[model samples]
Target: MAASSWPVKIYNSSSITTDSLKVPLHAFIRAYDAPTPSIVVRADTQVFLDSLAFQDDGKVLGFDLDHDGYDRLRNTEVRYLIDVYMPTRSLASLRAMGSGDVVVTPSALQNTSVVLTTAGSGTVFVSAPSIELANLNISVSGSGGFQWDVPATKVTSGVDLSVSGSGTLALSTTTLDAGSLKMAVAGSGKAYVGASSLVNVSSSVATSVAGSGQVNLYAAGTCRDHKVSISGSGDAFVSAMNCRDTSAVIAGSGSAYIQSTTTLATSVAGSGRIYVAGTVPGGLPGSYTPMASPPVTTYNAVPVPAYEPHKTKFGSHVSTGTSWTRDNATLIGVLVAVLIVLLVAFGVYRCRKSGRACFRSKTERPVGYARKTSTENQAPSMA
Candidate 1:
């Protein structure tokens, strides 16, 4: 229906013609209510507003009797309705449907017995509910998707459905084509999807499976955690990487407990613990293999020798060694010390050639640059 609040003018009985009838919002509005600005529907009937009241015998006149009251009713569309022609389009709530294909709506409450049944190949979507469908068989054919707004309270076999929430969906029967099903949990919600045969899932964050048949989980990922509890006759195969940002735990407790039918190969950082109560007829796979039978009875014993203490060789060869990593800094320090000693020795050798006085007393004074002295003795002129 076009969800709006307009002045509703529909037909009423002859008994309620002259009498006043209060109008309700959206659907029900009666005659002689008011003669204000209304959606006048007097085309078929002879209903008209002569005075402040309606002058009709069958049709309803939805105008205000008081001028101010009509203006107030226009603002607040109470006791008014627009024509409803809401064809099913948006997938909302769903109830127990017939054995045929159905559409979706929001008001499909749980008490309304919400379910989507398909007799043919068309798709059907429904809201999640924990109710009963005593003798209802819903068949969704190949290559079709059925989405439930909420997680199912209870479900039946041959039903391929997807739920989007963190609510628990109790599985009454196995969800066939579980790989075809798409599910997303809020944080770390749990799902117990089991089956009699193989359940092939395409994309799911976290889900648990426990049934007599194989459970194949594929393309499952999420930022939160998820887990699967297995208690069935067949092996559970999680083909997808059951990787979560938080902790994800998978457990198995059964006679034929096969935690991984496939290889669990990853380089991520996590811990996995295994516990086994009793030994099974079949041996544990991979790392949990059993010990070999037919224990060795005896062997020729060798005499033990003593007194062996060899020196450790650390360089090039085992037998012979070299000074590859000897004291380099010590050698450099020795060389520097030798250079300093040589420099000191050279300085001493040059200094010993003259008296230990000022450099001015080392050589004969220069003739031109000689200092003036009153006691200067001039040498005789040489020939």
Candidate 2:
């Protein structure tokens, strides 16, 4: 079943044929053609190891799970660096033998097994440009899906090659995934390479985003969970900092543009027409993205509004039937003195029912006039 892309090199050292192989411990080491034995990893099962003097293609470096050869490799970290005591998961070359490889999932490790021992000197002790983890020589690119690449001889982790995926493509010590690849999770998944993402500096790439989720993109065969998309045209240069999304969906349609450090909850649906230059903080709700078709045609402007102070916190108070508090100016002066005493009692009851006598608020007085005149006349007479 031949179908290996990108700089090809299945387990170099010249393709392997069994030279210095000792896979000791209880040694099962199946997969010569598959029946399930040589530490079976199933699917495209392979078994070959005879790198003509370990051309570095054939690697076997410093393994120290506290020595004793990792107690004969059962499973540690993640395995299959390459069968027997396993450890040599090949992406074809460019490797670093972490010598603790294992990959025998017959069913969540059912009947779980591990028994391998080795006797060297048959030729296999090569290391070039390695930086710990046993041996180092690198080159790897693999994918079951989500766009994949990178493979062209130069691996060594017990002996070049290793990649098992349901999702999440990895291998630390400086990783550079090349093109547009995507991944989901569960075996630690993630891969996407739109925007012409490339990295090739001899091959030692890493400067953060070293691990932990998110590679969701929607297009050219979609991808999901905790998204990472780029559509239509692509122009990206995202740096990276504090991101913890269990499943935060960030969508972009066609003209894709995303900055970073974003947060929002509940209802947020955009149907186009959202153009912001920057700085619009304080609260943020007021036509933030509600362009329901209007005289829309704005460019280079400033209009930010959305602030409700509530005049000193929680609607100040001013009832008056007995008492509330905050006296907003004595409740407008007792509602303007009860509207001027109800307009002087309705104008003295409409001047005593229209008979008219509401002069000084109801004028009607002449009863003592006569008595005053009589008293004046009498006094003159007596004198």
The TM-scores, one per candidate, come to 0.22, 0.19
Highest lDDT among the candidates is held by which one?
1
Runs of candidate 1 with Cα error greater than 4 angstroms are: 1-91, 103-205, 213-216, 220-222, 234-236, 244-383
lDDT per residue, candidate 2, 1-383, as tens digits? 32231122133233332222322111122223322122211112121111101122243211112222232222322212233322233221212121111122112111111111111101011112212222322121122211112222122222112112222222222233221122222211233322222222222211111112222221111111122222111111111111121111111111111111232111111221121112223324432232111111111111111111100111222221112232323233333433433354445456557876543321322222121100111110000
State the lDDT of candidate 1 residue by residue for 1-383, as single tens digits: 22223223543233322222121111111112332212232211111122123333333222223333333333331221222112222111222111112233333222322233221122243333333332222222222223333332332222333222111221322223322232321111122233323333333334333322223332222222223333222222332322222122322221111223222211111111222212322443332212212111111111111111111111221100111222233234434543543454345446545645212222322222222111212121111
Q: What clash count goes with each model?
A: 17, 59
- Which regions in candidate 2 have their CA more than 4 angstroms from the true location? 1-169, 175-183, 186-227, 230-383
How well does model 2 score by local distance difference test?
0.22
Error of 2 at 225 (Å): 20
